[model samples]
Target: MTGNRFVTQALGEYTLAGLANCSAEIVKTARPVNLNLFSIKWPVTALVSIAHRISGVLLFLAMPLLLYLFELSLSSEAGFRRAGAMLASPMPRLVGWLLAVALLYHLIAGCRHLLMDMGFGETWRGGKAGARTVIAISVLGAILAGILLW
Candidate 1:
């Protein structure tokens, strides 16, 4: 049989062929739709998961700036002084603090994920508690990072 005829004959053999046609409409109505992000009340576990993803993006975006600074500092004596001065500025210090905090949070969240993979904190209650602990540790780390950065 030709490809189209074969497909048609196979589809004619099952109820799923009819379902395939209406699948889009069925999916649209079968699931709960919430497009407004602000209107939803997010749980701690969800928030932490989102934050973990965002921190990963932030870290990826920061790589170029960090690499440039590293290259500049190693180029020459003058370049090293320039890099140091740039870091000493308020904006660079703030960026450094943010980077540090993001790193700390990402690290803690990653550890949580690793533990979950190992079958720890896989339950709803345990996951929530783990998320809260991650946030608490991140906050404390952020404060310490700010203190040390400035």
Candidate 2:
């Protein structure tokens, strides 16, 4: 028999009412939509971890601005003064502080990853402890820098 005619005959037999959807065991599926409810507990450690990654990305994107500043400082003593003076502006100072913190976090995280690669933090507990150490170091460095800056 022709393929078209066979398909038509098959459809005529198992169709539900007028339409052709009579296959057994229809499956249902869904993706979890996270609605921020008050009942949900936000993890501080997770947030800090995400912020570390975001800061890394911010640092990467700010490379051009940083390079410009660096070049300006190295160009001449007058250029150094001008670049230094730019940091005196509140916005630039704030950005500089953020960049410093990002640098600290990146450095600490890199060390942690390096240790992990050396088979130090291979287990679950080891990883968590390493993360905590990174946080502590980053926080202490940031606090020290902040105190000095402010």
Candidate 3:
């Protein structure tokens, strides 16, 4: 029966008994959330979340280009050579590196999310640490991809 204290207060002319449980119900006024894109500094966890979403979208949009390249490389010998030559150029190489980096980041972030969903790294400190680890690994993988691309 241990619970909140009942504080009786006056409302009008009638004297009420101790019936109001003010301590039981704590209400906080909600503040208006400002979502100005450039006004707020995001934390590491938020940055990782945003990058995860962006990387996923980038991979989805690059699917058509990847499919086209696959089809071109398999169509004919000349087409295969053309595809190879196209990939050899600087612009295409850069784009390929970017796609590779995005894919790596998305994959790592997805694994982190899965682990969190499975009850791992569920605490606030653990979540932030996991996010930092994901970012560090993704950056290292991206650097290796860039080195390979060049």
Best by TM-score: 1
Task: Estimate the TM-score for candidate 3.
Answer: 0.73
Per-prediction TM-score: 0.74, 0.69, 0.73
The reply for model 1, stretches above 4 Å from the true place, is 1-30, 33-35
**Predictions: Cα RMSD each:** 11.6, 14.5, 11.5
Q: Pairs clashing in candidate 3?
A: none
The local distance difference test score of model 1 is 0.80
**Top lDDT model:** 1
- Candidate 2 weakest lDDT stretch, 10 residues: 27-36
Cα lDDT tens digits, model 3, 1-150, are 000011111111122222143233331222223334344445577788889999999999999999999999999999899988887889998999899999999999999989988988867677789989999999899999988777
In model 2, how large is the Cα lDDT of residue 5? 39
Over the stretch 1-150, how does candidate 1's per-residue lDDT look in tens digits?
A: 122333344444543455566778795675433334454446677789889999999999999998999999999999999998887889888898888899999999999999988989887778889999999999999998887777
lDDT of each: 0.80, 0.70, 0.74
Task: Give per-residue CA lDDT, model 2, range 1-150, as digits (tens).
Answer: 122333344444433243434333341222223333243333333444566689899899999999999999999999999999997888888889999999889888877767777889656566667778888888899999888777
